[model samples]
Target chain A: MKDKDGVSGVDSSSSGVNRRDFLKVGATAAAVAGASSVGMAESATAASFNPKKFAGTTVKILLVDGERDQEGIKDKISYIQKTHGIKVEVTALALGAQLEKIQSVLHAPTSEYDIIDNLGFTVSGVVGGGLFTKLNDYIANKELTASTYNYPADFPAGQLDYTSRYDVAKNKFGGKDVYLIPGMHSGSVIMFYRKDLLAAAGIPVPKNWDDYIDAARKLNTGGVSGTTMIAANDVSLILVDWYARFASMGGKLMSGTPGAKNYKPNLNGATAVRAVQHMIDCAEVSPKGVGSFGFTESVDAFSRGDVALMLCWSTIAGSAFNPATSKVASKIGAVQIPGDANTSGRPIRGGWGLGIPKNLPQKRKDAAWMVMQYITSAEFDKYQFDKYQTDPNRRGTYVDAALNKKYPYLKVAGQAMENAKMLDVALIPECFELVGEAAREFNLAIIGSQTAKQACANAQASWEKILKRAGHLA
Target chain B: MLYSLGISFFEFDRVAGKWNFLGLGNYKEILSDKVFWSSILVTGVMVGVALIVEVVAGVSLAIFFGQKLKGSKFVRAILITPMILNPVVVGLMWRALLNPQWGLINWFIGLFGIDNPPIWLADPKWTLWTLIFVDIWQWTPFIFVVVFARYQALPMDVFESARVDGASPLKIIRYITLPLVSSAVVFAAIFRGIDSFRTFDLVYGLTFGGPGRSTTTLSFYSFENGFVYYRYGFASALSYIMVIMATIGFSVLLKWIPVRRNH
Candidate 1:
């Protein structure tokens, strides 16, 4: 085929045109055309890109172990070394601690790992701090091929939106090409309850805020707390849950567009105030120490059969129903979070992604990109689901017969994904701290120290202050 | 001296690398922050309350153990056990013990005919006090050990002289014993005060400055702003404020300790 620029080809028959010169020119033209046609693809077959053959070279990765994907770090390292010829060192850190560690490392020039598994929020920090290599050139140069890369398409639109940068001028994402790959996506705030208990109480599983309140009140009657949620001073979990419930109630934390540094506070409106009030009411029926409880306390309360319902992550369903982990496992059941007046059928999405750190050497980055491709591939998603019970983030993986049988809950979780909204706080990093602080103030009101109105007012004031300090106030 | 010593370094170049020197602009921003002021007030209250509790209980325990009583040695060792355990471990253990649902404290409350026990850590009004309890439980013994050792080292003649003067036990304690041990008390308070101001591991491990920022001290606030939120400049400003507050506290404490007198 002729090049788009219509450059003339060398004469093959002329004796003046050496065979070698003709071949080199022909190859160079073909290469340039190929690179332009499909960005980030090298002229190599997927079958030949064997990561296992690069054994002597070691790569370090940081990942969080979700409930479903609790792969033993040793086994993963060993398999990568044996199969791909590369020695992989994986450090599986807890969710919160990992965020802290990533923030500290990214702030400095040199990073501890060749690759870091970061969420969209952390990726924003990495981007803002110029910590990650811009993949636009690499993608355009065909150094990273999407066909061989196997980027999962099953991640919800919100998850994709969260990870990809928004070019305000273009009003499009993934337009600048990929910066981070959606590693794993799961629903952040899922409403779970003891199915048996709800049935026994003659109350149906709640489908909306009114029903939820009624069910909680009924559950609170039998010496059991109505619902368990993270209300402690740690704002990340609390705000995620708050946003989930608020979205269900037709409220939003902020308005404008993603990656816009100057967004207005849409959370202090009437809808937001009502959402805060509902949470305060829920707190009344919660366990005695609900305000002080973090993730562990909330989960423990639900798992121990002391609480009738819990609004948490989809990853928590397995733990809540595991006999070893929960006393109420046999009676527990999972469902979508109840909707509020505004949002009658929306679930919140909370999970992280994999991105190339800017500080990595070019060769190391190439290697790291390969690893990300391998893990996020269709074959790997199957392996992850079958071996570890981790649900895949790809659409095809959700319908895979084998995965459905092994983890029936994934079907429900997958359904929740269709209605998933990215927890608003994750988009703005400072919002996490602000929301957490606001939630604590709300908790103070819930426990009767502060009135519900007072709590809302305090939260609005606090949130406004944070936005002002971040130069985002409208 | 500053140039020769690598330890006494500042990131002047890094600071000047990007932004203009606002000359304490960040500090000005911090001073104007209500959260900053609130954090300062919280830390002050926590330190003051914790110190007072530690001193009273510590002094009493030291005086009690100073007496020659049966099983006093065993009690002393048991009381000091909390200090030996890691602060994180101690925090977790107490969290379990004070847990509203399954904790022993709540279980005992049930025995008292109470329907629902107050969630010690969960209640905003009670959260700070709960942290205080944990701090006192862990560190009161340090004070006890110090005060007890000093009490034992007091010359026997001083008490004998008070006794010969027909002084009552209360009078002897107030006039003689108290004055002699005042130096040791000052030293312990200074050390403990500084340590308490920087307390992170135990409080973080226990409450994480939660139930609505009721338990957040200056250090916790600094951590949240710096690492969690990635506001390095703001965090640096908070750190400097902490340093100033600590320095002032130390200076005021040192004034009470007699530099010339060897106790």
Candidate 2:
């Protein structure tokens, strides 16, 4: 696969799937036609979708533990051995340990696992560093990928930019370069509400932040909290809760670039203060001790029928629709997050990506891509969602009429996924530090210990110091 | 240990996959960092309050259990259950019980006609206190078990002599019984103090350092920097400072609390 130059024999046929443009040509007008034209099935034209492309190789996949990333693949192990004729080994680890392992191995001369899953936030660190081989050649190589294996066209553009593509030279996400593929499941932040409660209160559904707060205040009664969110000192506090309001309200997170050394964070701006104030207002109408609520606490409260509204990652709160785990399962309705007047809802993208290491032997890299292709295909996407409830990364899966009829939230989650914005912090390695500091300061505001202005000012100060230490700021 | 000390002088460059020497830069940065100082204060308060309550409660229980009253065996066994449980589990259990809404604690207090009780995990005033209380609940039994063994092994002749010499029961207990178990009490206190000083998992499981850094102990802070932020140098420096503080604090404690093995 090697040419004179390029990362891992990357051909000159544009790093990104050119079909993205062709898919964009007709837009949603041809979505169904789009899915059918390029979408692959498990048993397709044998010449294009050969199950035995790599008949006698072993491929190992490293996946996250609790997200059910392994179950979909594990359940089909026998089929993989029989159909693909490749021995598949899967090792799943908890979040913290898995991230550490990814970092340690990404730089090794030879990678132990042929395929590794990349969390969206860690994109700038590992992928931007060019630790993974560029996959442009694989996507364009017809022999390697099936013709019916729809890629850039079938996946949402936001998820593609966030998880699949990278601009290594500029040290940012989403450019012409394609280093990874959105794998398994992808998700976005969506607003969840109680249909029963809203109907009883005669309150119209919220379309923006202003209407949202008004509805929350009016509905905060009868032993049910108006809203709950990730207000604790967790990274999700910033990524999910604060960013939803801030981005929707037209807040710009930062300016300049890391290389220019003028990267200045604008946490103390008016929009930021307003977003924080909005959360504090919601906390007033929320359950007692809402300041201490993390994802589990917030989701549990909502599922137990004590909370009237919430904004959460669909992948996580999707369980709220199951009767076995939720008292309000039948009472729930989900929609895209509300935006302010001028702008639209722009929740940050959330999901993992699958990539091959740059240092892998050529044979394994080829084998890994063959497995990745089948796994990310629209056929597998449908099966995984149908079987495991893992979120779907493909747009076609979201709009699948049959799946949407069964899981109503699929339609709303798809719309949000298309509109989702990648967290600007994901562009830098100091991301966790930046988000963590902001989460703490805002959490203090949510608890009423600090005013919204003070909290924003504090976050501003801390972020600047971190940016300066990292030499990304003057 | 030596590698951590060495790593303290260097900051890791994640993208480049190498370390850049920043000799004394990390130390200087940590010394001026407000979060580090606040964590130190939190650790100090947690260790002091939790250790004192544990020693006092444990010694009191040991003395009472030593009386060998009816069913004391079963009660003693029940009292040490928290001690045997993992610290993280203890933290999580207390967090659930202390949850302001729908928690068993609030419900129980409500039945007593106290409608408004403290929000244990949320309020800054109570978050740290709740963590300390959980620590005391889990560790006080260690002190009880250790001191009880010594209390039971004490020679009977001494107490009998004191009673024979016209000594009141309370007086004999305070003057004679206490001194004999002083060594065991001192050992348990000092040991508990060090463990409490570097406590990490409880803080991680319970508060995550806070609604606003209210419960951020030094160890947790060090871990947040090292693992969460990937600021290895800063975390290593913070850890070294903790080692120094713990070494000196325990040294002074050992000197102040004299453990007399023989009367």
Candidate 3:
């Protein structure tokens, strides 16, 4: 149904369920319905739900636009609007500013964002604060399906696991059932190298920790700096990368046992100590004045051909490959970061998701889920890779012939994805700050300002104190 | 009366609705926080050092330009130009200048036979002082303009009377000029002190309180905790503490120096 003002006329009955009733009914229905509906809805929607036929529906999506996805999707906005008769409004914000805006909006009871992109930092908080709708019901009820959505299969299993939480200790639905759907699978901190430079230096592409050191040394002799990583306040990205490597080294940041909130400083353990020493060794070979490098500085240095290698996100891959933005574009090659002996087989994974705001009307929540499902469908995964150069999170997309042909490096990313490990840190609300503080001390240690033992000890002490304040530490 | 009533109402709304009223809880946390205390020490050092440099340099420039010379007006205009630029812009300009790899400062330092110039903003120990240097460069112009105006407005007769008494130029300046402009000096100190306490834009743009929190000031800490970390209650507590400190500092300065009247 469509109103004169262009708002979709959702059934009034859908709005009657209160918060308590929905919580009681939603979880039970979701679990039972999810298994049966996986293959049920493919034909029902594909035959009838035509975007061109549906008119007068407006969808508001909040997105961070500075990255490749936003730039790639901007051109398609008009096409989607014209075809579907759906008016889509995208609000582009700086990454940090977007987080603050979303948090402030979520904190207010009557806030009005229908759909929001979910950063890893805000996912737990948003869910715990009851600011997001659980999508398990929609997925289970067959209201949303793989055909209707774009990225349903593009997501990696690990990403899906991270997005979904189990309240195993309490044997509950964890307050919400899968609050987010992985929209863009662009999270791995890939290492970008100058292929030409490596060839000139007669060095092989680094595969493991030892290879990485040897390559760095070879690159250093040619007047080219070894590698660059973010060490600034926004060093959370790099810290996550380091955690992935530590996990590869068989060092767990926290025990995965459910119900246990307090975590010990396993970072001081042998595996973690070795990993930190490896990072310190890498730091010594990094360019002069690497201590103050943030995401922008590190990326700029790599793109400008000032550094031999940059350990950063796949999200920046498109920019690094563009001839206009990068001086070393044609010479650049992608590879998974080298893991330690224990983690040599694993790769690090990082990315964000899309979810409905819990405060919206039930009809709006359903509509938002409809939009999310459509955007993450198989078709859209191809569209994203073709247009935006974003890596799909799904295993199938890794082997897509079209994708492989257009972006040969997707194979490298796929290999990294196969070995990808999640950050072994706690997913609690204060985890970001705790990780940031620890990373700062770790960076200090890497730059020779503090010893590895001293850095880990100091980080443990600081983290213990922070966790104590948050009631997570005994 | 109206203004007082409005302020009271605003204060009531803020206390009742905005703040969580954790009372001593946040204060206790701040007291025990090593990061908080370390930031306080850093802020104190920065403000103290920058203030001394700004006042001394600013006053000297003010006195220098107070003398009549050809193109004096043009020189005065150029000297006060930095006061009009935004703090963020000033910071970015200086960050570019101080960049170790490509910076003009490092380039200039290389010409002086110093082969290895220190990474000014990248090193933990030098970041705070480097930020202070940028602040002094930008805000000292404000002080110079204010003090120069004060110098221009000084009575010609008082200096003439001092000169008739056989007082040297230095003596006349020390006794007559300095005493008359004491309020202006106090004004500059108090204003600069209050502004420096809340300084964020420049420091944020330049150092981002980094190289391991070496340049993190109290205001920057408050912003990070409140906005970045989403600890609204703790941030509110920090703001209140800053307010009390600023009020006390201003009150003492006001009491110490009475405003000059046009007798």
Per-residue lDDT tens digits of candidate 2, residues A1-474?
Answer: 221321111111422222233234324523643454354434446456565778799999999897777888998788778867888999998676688788768778899999999899998889878899889999887767777666687777778888999988877788988888997679988899999999999997787899899999999999899999899888989999999999989899999988899988989999999999999999999988888887878989999999998999888787788777789888999877787766666678899999998889999999898888778877777778776667888877777767777777876776667667788878899998899899999999998899999999999999999999999998
- In order of listing, the candidates' clash counts read 20, 0, 16
Give the distance in Å from residue A122's predicted Cα in candidate 2 to where it truly belongs. Answer: 1.5
What TM-score, over all chains together, does every model reach?
0.83, 0.90, 0.83
| Per-residue lDDT of candidate 3, residues B1-263 (tens digit) | 34422222221111112423444677777788787899888888888888889988988888888888889899888878788998878987987898777899999999999988888887787888888988898889878878888999987988889889999999987878777877788889789978887888887888778768888899999888877777776776777777778898789878987776552
Local error of candidate 1 at residue A51 (angstroms): 1.6
Weakest 10 consecutive residues of candidate 3 chain B by summed lDDT: B8-17
DockQ of 1: 0.44
Residue pairs that clash (backbone atoms under 3 angstroms), model 2: none
Best by lDDT: 2
lDDT of 2: 0.84
lDDT string for model 1 (A355-391, tens) is: 7777677777777765665565555655665555444
Cα error of candidate 2 at position B142, Å: 1.6
Per-residue alpha-carbon lDDT of candidate 3 for residues A1-474, written as tens digits (9 for 90 to 100): 222532112122321222233233334433323322242223444544433333466677777655655654466667666545566667767676788888766657754566787665445556555567767667665334443342233345556655544232232223335777776545566677898988888886675667777788678755678877665545553354466457656676765332364555565777667777777787777777776676667788888887887677676565677666778778888765655543343445566777787677665665566556656555555567666667765544555655666566665565455445555443566666787777778777766788878877877787777766655566
Candidate 1 ranges beyond 4 A from true positions: A1-46, A64-71, A92-96, A134-149, A154-157, A164-176, A236-238, A257-262, A340-342, A377-391, A425-429, B1-21, B68-70, B151-180, B257-263
DockQ for the candidates, in order: 0.44, 0.66, 0.37
- Model 1's CAPRI class is acceptable
Clashes of 3: 16
**Docking quality level of the chain pair in candidate 3:** acceptable
